[model samples]
Target chain A: MSNYLSLENVGITFKTQNGPFRALDDVSIKIEKGEYVTMIGHSGCGKSTVLNIVAGLLTATEGVVLLENKEVNAPGPDRAVVFQNHSLLPWLTVYENVRLGVDKVFAKTKSKAERDEWTKHNLKLVHMEHAMDKRPGEISGGMKQRVGIARALAMEPKVLLMDEPFGALDALTRAHLQDSVMEIQAELGNTVIMITHDVDEAVLLSDRIVMLTNGPSATIGEILTVDLPRPRNRLALAEDPHYHHLRGQVLEFLYHRQLRPAA
Target chain B: MKSNIVRLTPQQESPPEESTAVIPESASNAASTATRATKSVEKIPASTTRNYALWRASGTTLIKNIFLPVLTFLVVGVIWSYIHSHIAPEIPSIADTWTRAKEILADPLAQNGPNDMGIGWQVLYSLGRVLGGFALAAIVGIPVGFVMGMSENFQKAVQPLIQILRPVSPLAWLPIGLLLFKAVNPSAIFVIFITSIWPMIMNTAAGVKAIPKDYMNVAAVLRLGKLEITRKILLPATLPHVITGMRLSLSIAWMVIVAAEMLTGGIGIGFYVWDEWNNLNVPSIIVAIFIIGIVGIILESVMTLVHRHFDYSR
Candidate 1:
């Protein structure tokens, strides 16, 4: 039986000049509606490849991906992404950057005023209402990422794909973003698939943390469930043993089992 | 009650990031006290004077910016006078050239006949042709550049053709343009078109290539239509580069128009310069040279402003 979003035996083999290099193999995940999942691994472990396949930005050579019980073939607005570097268009103001997606995706459903309201609403959701007129270049990195999240959220996609959304942000900024994301996710109940290297981030944000082994042919090594109760306050969770246990399991999987030498 | 200690945001706290303007307000406060304490420094007066003092601290700006350039111009005049006195009788002296330039300026819009039109008319005619050719080149080349950038196979297929055609001289294209259009004006315009299009295409394509993959990925996720992508993403992203291409193309077109009009034998600065040579009017030819340089500077400055407006990379 298929889940809300399912990747069954998904794999990719790139045709490089050297030869065919297998990046991922036999990777499968079944995501339910409103489930927040984080994929964690070393940099080259096909974590992004897996995310890409689900988002239909990359086609899996081996198997199928079903989103809302339909075959996922090419990229669509249904799988809106928050890119690592906060890919807000530098040329457009923060409002227009989000509105660029909002205008296109909601072209059919939303009226002009409704669309405008929706754009402002989404920008407000990310605490970026004051900077609506500023270009992406004018904003801070954390702020840009907030707008990136706002842009993706405005689409109201079936699945929100974040490829290391907080990777480029500072520790404090990352915590703020993580908290905001948690707050947003709790309110909206949006299905999220975030790829991250931070074990604590994965545990804090995800209902389940899917760990992957190192590549040549990377696949899911283990899936660790974080059974912590929410609204999971980071300060409160710092003292919670269950949060520590869940974090430890993910850490054990990464450093102990899936260890690769520093290149 | 207001707080005694002020908190600085990270932006303000970072000394390296602080703009020079910030230093002035703080310095002015200290400068006011210093001015009050000492009557000797009172002659300088306000912030403008303080800025001048700061300018002195930097040193050599006045000499480098103003004095040196004036000195250079005087040196050039001296050299021109020496050359006029000794070597080339064909070359007019600076004063004679200036007088001829004044005569040309006196009746700039005179329309006596086709060949006996004023210097302004010739310049205008040349400008019209350059603009036409430059506009056509932009309309054609910018889209071609976009196509080349968007498609790898197209870029590869067309790269060799562009390389081969780009280096073919403006004079060489003039003959081809004459044969094709079989008209003098169009032929000159065509030479400008051929000379200018390469930089536009190359620069625009480079701009398209320089865009980060993340942007296209955002487009992909949005499922932006081809037209929407162009309007919302591609066009704006490549605009600064397009302006740069236009700037380069305009300058080249300005340079080539003189040669182009000379070859085609038409109404332009190029033709004027050539006709003045035929008449042995060396002073007028010197004036034409100055006109060419002036027009080029104006076109270049306008385009540079446009480039700065669109340049998001900075």
Candidate 2:
């Protein structure tokens, strides 16, 4: 598979009150077309920093990021991000929030009806059609996250970026959303890069799990490939030895090999 | 009868049965029998008791909210009467003030001339000035506030000037307004504008600065145009704070208008108060005081309603 997104030797430094602070150093990763990759690490390990770099919300202090052979210098519709907090505008209804992205990305090329249809279609993908008229504040946390996902998907982005999108949700809700995302990925075959702290989630959803070391200056620690069959069921996987092995491998890596001192 | 017996038996038996299972059955039998007998006798329906509780709750709330305030007003009236009868006679008794208030309100809209207009006309004239000045302040203040909020350097440059000007009494500005405009009405309005503009500018700038980083990040990621960001994100986000500023500005304007009008000598409630005081119509002056208080309360309550309407966070 051709590399659809690549970050080469990416580094980020912050000028804090105490002087220069390196958040990430010499971070490099290549994400292939139609692949679902997740970056996993403990807190403050620059997992989100990597995702932000790809989203073009942050410019690296060193190296370069390329998306489809184009330099990723600024945020655009091409890379749509589902933020950790599900940052839907409180004043807007679910439909309007999704429409905001659709209108911005497609207004020049698409008709109004086409944009509306696209918005509705994306909301339907996340089963948020029922709440299309409800404001973000009126919905449950899970429903808000679904709307966030719909908003990202509506942009018809080249790559979907998620920064611990289900981190705030309960375990059951997170599992249900992970299943929905897996199904959506299977259907659309869109490239996805997600940042997560959950080991089980990394094993369940990702084609490749890129682990990062703890930071003051963090870098990629290891990469693990999941060769599990698609259309994976959690209950069935609970009984599968291979699935258990993958879960164990991630646990061992997180706890034994690359565990943060404070954690 | 059978269904009633069934329900009562379970209700009466379950607790004792469970307790008997834990303890000795023979030991609790007499106590259980006594309790059952009392429970059967006192068979009030659950719904009726619930309804009674709800009614009592609402009655308590009504007494707390309505009755207390009315009682306080009556007590204040009694105290005022006592003080007028026993203390200095210059302060009009509540009854005397009420009588004068009735007389003034009876022909409130009557007009002999600009100098001798009714209380209603005076109030209207004052309201017009306050609103005009407030509207002008809003027009000028909101944009300046936005600019200051959007740029730190601009805020720093403007901060010292605003600090120096803001705390200077609105009455102090009256002389400057008189010098600049050389007209009573415009000078009164200029005082109102000067006083009211500060709250709007300060509150709106603070509101703009407080716009959450998450919303800005969304704007950045979406690549929304400058106009779109301002219209969709900035305006709505800062609206509650802007309304709060407007509320403060309006109350300040109302206050300054009374003092300003007293100095300017126009057909206003404030002027009416001064006129009554000059003629030694103490009761009528008291009536004017009550009217001023009532109008100020109304203005504040109206602004509070507007503020609540724009408060999207709740």
Candidate 2, residue B192: lDDT: 85
- Give TM-scores of the second chain, every candidate: 0.82, 0.83
Where is the poorest 10-residue window by lDDT in model 1 chain B? Answer: B1-10
Model 1 chain A: ten consecutive residues of lowest lDDT: A1-10
- In model 1, where do residues sit more than 4 Å from their true spots? B1-63
Q: What digit string (tens of lDDT, one per residue) describes model 2 on residues B1-314?
A: 32234433333333321322223332244334434544655655754464465445445544555566679889988888888889977898777888888989999999887777789899999999999889999999998998888999999999999999999998998989999999989988888888889999999999999998888889998999899999999998899999999999898888888888889997898888888889999998878877888899889888878997877664
In terms of docking quality, model 2 is medium
lDDT of 1 at A174: 99
CAPRI band of model 1? Answer: medium
Which residue pairs of candidate 2 clash?
none
Please provide, for model 1 over A1-263, each residue's C-alpha lDDT reduced to its tens digit, 9 standing for 90 to 100: 44799888988999999999999999988998999999999999999998888788898999899898799989988899899999888888999988888888888998999999999999999999999998886678899999999999999999999999999999999999999999999999999999999999999999989999999899999998888888989999999898898898988989998889774
lDDT, candidate 1, at B208: 93
- Candidates' C-alpha lDDT: 0.86, 0.86
